[model samples]
Target: MTTRFLRSSSVLIGLAVCGILPQLHAQSSPPTEWVDPDTGHRVVQLSTEPGSESLYFNLNPFTPDGRKMVITSPDGISLVDLATRSVEKIVSGRPHIIMVGRKTGQIYYVDSKTENGATSRLVCSIDPATKAVREILKLERGQSVSTVNADETLLGGTFTERTDWDTNSYFEGGPNRRTEARTADQQRDSKGQLMVERLDKHYPMGLFFHNIATGETKSVNRGTDWLGHLQFSPTDPDLLMFCHEGPWHKVDRIWTIRSDGSDLKLIHKRTMIMEIAGHEFWSADGKSIWYDLQTPRGEDFWVAGYEVSSGVRTQYHLQRDEWSVHFNVSPGLTFFSGDGGDAKMVARAENGKWLYLFRPELLADRSDGNLDTKGLIRTGVFHAEKLVNMGKHNYALEPNAMFSPDMKWLIFRSNMSGATQAYAVELEKGDAK
Candidate 1:
């Protein structure tokens, strides 16, 4: 089956004619609603704050009922009512956001304070409706919480012990580490170098579980492989998934372990050199782990899935232009969303600057009536549809696109208005000119 899919030239011309060219400046009060000329999708700016942004692609920022979404901005953490699109600042100061409780409908975050050159992080949760706050625990300077379990009984995170290395050394020699002193290109290169250094050093880190009720913390797994991206399964309270953080091509990347720290198993084994897989996320049902897969580092792209129980694999191929920084599935699994990357991205995808909606079509089975060949790995392709033109947006701020709980909109962040802000594109494209 052919893997390449071409976009329309007329749509590109339409976008250019609409003044949606690259590097468009910000407006004091950008339009709240507008129809995307490239795809005719109705795009809505959800936040009024200049630097507002949604949670990371893997994090769940929506409340259990899906009526409210937790967003962060220069002001603080806020809640957006999906029905009315009203924004309310629920938390005042800039606290590091953890994740919303899947069952409790509470917003979890970390409030930090620096005293005598030492920082203390207080883990807390807030009720959006009642505006009540609950303090969970205090973490040491190097300790942090990343995720809450399915039942909201435990918090999962990692702690690093880097006594031998100067923490400031990561950014010390890199053009002064100030935003004003370094261009985005230089910053990107500097970060890449820091990652290489960290990976080569194999810094000591450990995964831990914090009991919210007992206020007890227990170390589960310890390693020097640069442990990061800790996430608990949305369905299973005891199952936790984490990654060996580094350059994607260098590490095994994904692994799963019990909350109590047993059964540490690598999810994907590299079959060939330069084969890389990372940016993994769980399916809505938690039955499969989906991730970006590249064979020989950027030559080909795929969104691959692995069944945890059956050990089966499925891969959906996409064109170079369809490759996204992050991909998310709808609640109903009807379609997938891609926050496309820029030209400077690893994919080097020119004209890849668009928010895309993809319909996955599974390739037909080719068993040839052979029982032995049955149940082989399934392969498929994505039918891409452009939703929002991202040409004017900067790639430095990734558009971590995710589906709304109702699957009606794709929520993402963009700096098309000169400052990072949250935006959503309606899936139905209703009455969009």
Candidate 2:
């Protein structure tokens, strides 16, 4: 790949025409396309809109045809043609995006309207091509729609009882809440205290399903544990996964259940004190569930997998510097990618800020001359490769990286250019260092 550093006057003028230079006037414009000095991989900016961000790591942003991806900005939701690198605004509103329909390629989102201090969420889906929208269901206050099922028939989400302290004020407070600025350590401590208080309260929450065709809603399960991170299996419409959200170490986080409120199974049980697992996601084939696992909070790291059918376990060990806030697998399950974290994160890695590609290599068989003595659990190590040097990126804006449909690029969000924007790094063959 040819490296084009944006230092010349001509390049700046070109970027100005593209509407990217004005946003970078306070800071020097980062190269629109360049080869990383630390890693030979090529990186390109995908969205020209300031404050543009890619979808969450677990959410499927690509359409069913895999030719275009849906991205969000302050203006609205837009589509990026993967082949031509062209962007087109599709939905124009401040709607909260759910996920793209797995079968219909419709963009599903929620639009909120507040009336007389009461809020109602309208669940809707739009045809990306024609911009025609169909209102599916209307959710009452405190109700949310998070995931669309594999067949596009059911919408999975959670409903929570409103409380005076439910505004996530622990993390972000109103202007009048604090009179003085707090240091990073003080802020972390305050947030931790709030989390502990909330967890102890055991707030009431419920998991629900909404049928898109009939407009019927059903509550599947109700509990005090904070229900969150709801996701449906990409291949199995009935299989839904959620987490008991809290400080990771304090909760047995990963759980799966059927759509009809049966077979509620915990995916992982902490084996030791401070051991934690979260950030769970389903494999492309929906045969396995993967998550970031730490042996004992912040000490050891692994990308662990659970086979839903056979109840088997697989883990790939990673170094401290390789730990990421999120990890994702390719469509073909060829490899995995990580958006590396900074020093303030759990791993506290000195040189951890980078985009990484990992190839899992299973451990050699250790059963001495016994072919049938293989252990129930599988172990592996990652052959790590640096794809992009993210030393300048602000971890406050997570990189939420994932593989493109063709597996030729890794998409992520970054604030390296002084504004949060979406970017993609080319996964070039024969370019491994």
Candidate 3:
């Protein structure tokens, strides 16, 4: 059971009593409540587990049926059934190892446990309702699956030897040294410094893909020293996406290749005008790509999309005053949300941190774009609130929050009651109030 305790408004009230400020005199932490400005109605919370949390911000983590959401917690990989308001535990696995089948609605995960006293990792698919496990691919000791195709027939994994390294050798927030440590193919300088190796130009470290039906696996041969952030488009069985996996300005960040390992195309190439762009994702229809772009050192923030077939680039520039490194579009492209505070999601210029949602129509809006200064989010909801455990403020939940399949709720992770839990804020109908 969650350790219940008395709600404390005394701390903020004491500040007011000390003549610090009168504004927080009545400002105890409010419950999850936000009224729709359009209808004057309020949303409701769904998930209740104390330590519950959902998938990464970029990954949707929703099953095909839309009735359940995959969540990982101290317990295991579980499902939040929106219809019944119940959580069903599926299997025990590490967070970020779970996947929802795009076509079959099956749950897939990397099963790493001991069998007959021998430990191994297996890429397995499951029937969430029946808890039936089917092993599709067996991984090497260091290999881990990161992405699967729309049909779940093609999958990709990354293998590296630098799992143990002083990752912050270069800059404060540079990418981890996920590349292999072997220097067999590298030439040392006169000073005995290792030359920079570009794996995308030549694949040495294994960036491999496996075909489940044919039992064939091969290295696609297009990656950097470290490859990560793999994603398969829901509309194309042959289309797969991967990243160079490092800080911006290092190299081109995103690339798309066919499942058969042909037509390897660069999605976003950094240029002088637009210095860097990454955090790539597929649009709902798979006809285009969605990503965030900014000038060097995190300025000129812009949310951009590129049409895959037409080669069209559309950018909605946010005011230079506001900033966020990561941006995610809703399933229907109705609105997009931006967040900062994580290492990869920092706001280089902002004083504090926030998670803001914006209507698509208001993205480039010069009139009311400054939500932080305007007060109460414009275009849609302005949720500057955070959820975290009470005593341990630093153990704040990553509100990898996103819109539900039907766009009726804003789902996120919170530890407000002392445990990191997944919670949802419902979007009521226009006339509900």
Candidate 4:
């Protein structure tokens, strides 16, 4: 089932044709809204609690059988049956013991808790059906978990600390031991042989892969660099995609590497924009990736995509004043969350109130044999303006709205209930908006 979509010339192309100051169409559009089936109401409030500040979802829950949505909560991991709205707790907040696997019909996470500023870590698992708990690893001193990848096989965590020092013994100078510690008075003054204690420790800052079936564990070395996000290739477990502190520089870049710690490659690097600043996702087919790149200005940078195979990239530009639309659409376009395989839907808010939906096929003709910059800007603006007036509809505030493995259901995290909870929407040809 298909519908005719629109394609508008980019603000850039329109200007380039006239050949002026480059007329950069650096603006982006809002998200496309998915209409709620029941009450002509655009929003399907899934959470029962509302107006609760800080009640938000970080990751989109995964569906084991594409029928039930599994998610990690502050307490632990939980599963919600998409068809029935039945939620069963896999594990409660043990704070430092989140579960992190699900191949055997369960949920998993590594729990980390801070007590008086120190962290304790643990890896745990839970049954989706009966809600029973099982401990995988107990928190050892100085270890903290960060995120669990799509494959339960991998887990990311941090091991870090700091040190302090004392100041004295430079001006007075003189004891035999002071000579050994401070050297000559000139040397002491020049080198500042001040009595200082060296505080050194190694910290973990990455995702690790644990073989649940084999009991084998391996770590991804991000060294002393900041590891922002990590994902295993959907097609190959031996391959991985991650974002880290740019090599030799302070900026952040998306990279790919062989899981065995070889053949590391910078899949995409931005020169003008350095810090990634937010979350990113790999395409369902692992052919492309997406993330938001900020400019020197305070506005959120454009959300951009990179094609893994062709070396072609696409970016959606929105004005800093259009932050509402860009933020809303950024996540939807980055990931897929629907039952149908032929077409995908992405929604973003233009002004916090209005939303837009875009279909890739809508601008297929403008591909230019690749994802051209002109095509992206033109199509994005066209969709953003049209979606704003789609009556009243509420898209998921969280960027995730993906489908189960079988594409039989739509799984998304929602805060319509005030508290963020997992919910599902059925997909059909008629449902496309």
Provide the clashing-pair count of each candidate structure: 1, 0, 6, 35
Q: Residues 1-433, candidate 2, lDDT per residue (tens digit)?
A: 3222122357667888999867876566665666677887767788889877898899989998888999988868889887766889988767778889999999998876688998777989999888899988888766778899999999998887767654454422111022136643466547667677767777678899988888888897798987888899999999999988789998999999999999999999888999999999999999999999999999999999999998989999999999999999986667999999999889999999999999988898777786674446789999999999999887866799999887788999888877878888888733311
Model 4 Cα lDDT, one tens digit per residue, 188-299: 3443223221111123344455555566666656565544445565545566776653221244457777656687777645455433433455665566666554553244
Comparing 2 with 4 on TM-score, the higher-scoring candidate is 2
Candidate 2, which segments miss by more than 4 Å at Cα? 1-28, 114-119, 165-194, 369-375, 429-433
- Return the number of clashes found in candidate 2: 0
| Candidate 3 per-residue C-alpha lDDT over 147-194 given as tens digits, one digit per residue, 9 for 90 to 100 | 777888887766654443353222111121112343312211111222
lDDT by candidate, in order shown: 0.82, 0.83, 0.59, 0.42
lDDT of 1 by residue, 1-433 (tens): 1101112347656767898744243535666567788798888888878878888998998999888899888758999888777899999876878888999889998886788998777989998889999989888745767889999999988887777645435432111112445656576667787788878876677889999899888997887878778789999999999988889888899999998889999998988999999989988888889999999788899999888888889899999999999998876567988999988888899889999999999999766676685456789999999999999998877899999887778899889977888888888765533
Candidate 2 lowest-lDDT run of ten? 171-180
Cα lDDT over the full model 2: 0.83
Residue 308's C-alpha lDDT in candidate 1?
A: 88
Q: State which candidate, 1 or 2, has the greater lDDT.
A: 2
- The estimated TM-scores of all candidates read 0.89, 0.87, 0.72, 0.57
RMSD of each: 6.9, 5.3, 10.6, 17.5
**In model 1, how large is the Cα lDDT of residue 282?**
88
Query: What is the RMSD, in Å, between candidate 1 and the native fold over all Cα?
Result: 6.9
Quick one: ranking by lDDT, best first? 2, 1, 3, 4
**Candidate 3 Cα outliers beyond 4 Å, as residue runs:** 1-45, 93-96, 161-203, 222-224, 320-322, 340-345, 349-352, 362-397, 428-433
Better of 2 and 3 by TM-score: 2
